[model samples]
Target: MAVDPRGADLARLISEDPGGPVVMLNLLRFAPDGAAAYQEYSRRAAEFLHKYGGRVLYGGQGSTALVAETGQAWDAVLVVWYPSRDAFSSMVADPGYLEITSLRTQALSEAVLQATVPWPGFGES
Candidate 1:
């Protein structure tokens, strides 16, 4: 039932940074009547995302999983790219951004926010 990141999580993200940009993978599960609330949160968050050099590469509703565990199917998925971990940290820490996070917190029953690094195939340069 973890909807948001904590100080320790952010610190670890920084310490573990291998450098360069990072893409965040978000797997969201909504509470009852939560989808509308989450959509509002996303709308309000757009400006901040723009301010911090981040963008949502994809956002879509999740459906019955063709292959997965019983509880593995999520309500939605979002893939966001940020210039760096620091940018993400700063954006989340922003006073304005913090004010509106309640919407997201109240909306999600659970979530998975992960930093994913691109795997460069050998000889791709």
Candidate 2:
């Protein structure tokens, strides 16, 4: 089987950044036993991300606020920012972050990752 290292990649990418925004579209499958663990891990992750100057601008459950229609009631949503792409890359290379990978994987049944970049619009904030 092909081993997916995305969890590690995302964690490290956000953990070492000096400050910027990274938005995560969390699609956590509902599992009562895993909710607390997932949240705990996310909190710790936020701490690490902040150390890199990253900030989670907002995080909440999706309702009519999201663009896409999803059947699952995702546990939560997360948005974070890192200094730059290079800073994000640096975090991905850090070996120390490998330890937290399982915690994230264990707490969720599914997750989707997407990369977003800003687009300038006329008279639009």
Candidate 3:
């Protein structure tokens, strides 16, 4: 499973900009002994996120699913909010941030990263 985004994927993410903040939904499946590595990645990533006007809205280990497909269970879930799509793009493109990406790659056996849009009448805006 590929954890790192490709150049084309980044390009597409930027091109499809809806012009506002974006919440990234991350579903991660950790490799053996990967949790500790991911924790280190998170610690370092927090700084870059702050620099880019982003933050982790929520993060937690996955639990037993009440409802889901056979292969839909994830080991962890994270929701990161960026001030804008461009902010997220810039963060990922930063040289310093790029150097730390290997930690995330090494920590995950599989991952899903998706940009989420807020809907009307949702929980907090």
lDDT of each: 0.96, 0.57, 0.93
Give the best candidate by lDDT: 1
Question: Which regions of candidate 2 are displaced past 4 Å?
Answer: 1-24, 30-32, 64-73, 122-125
Q: Tell me the TM-score of model 2.
A: 0.64
Q: Which candidate order results from sorting by TM-score in descending order?
A: 1, 3, 2
Q: Candidate 2 overall Cα lDDT vs. reference? A: 0.57
**Per-residue lDDT of candidate 2, residues 19-90 (tens digit):** 544443444553447677777777666656765566666777655645555564566676656667555555
lDDT string for model 1 (66-94, tens) is 99989999999999999999999999999
Give per-candidate clash totals: 0, 10, 0
Task: Tell me which of candidates 1 and 3 scores higher on lDDT.
Answer: 1
RMSD of each: 1.8, 5.5, 1.2
- Output the worst ten-in-a-row residue range by lDDT, candidate 1: 116-125
Better candidate number, 2 or 3, judged by lDDT? 3
C-alpha displacement of 9 in model 1, angstroms? Answer: 0.4
- The number of clashing residue pairs in model 2 is 10
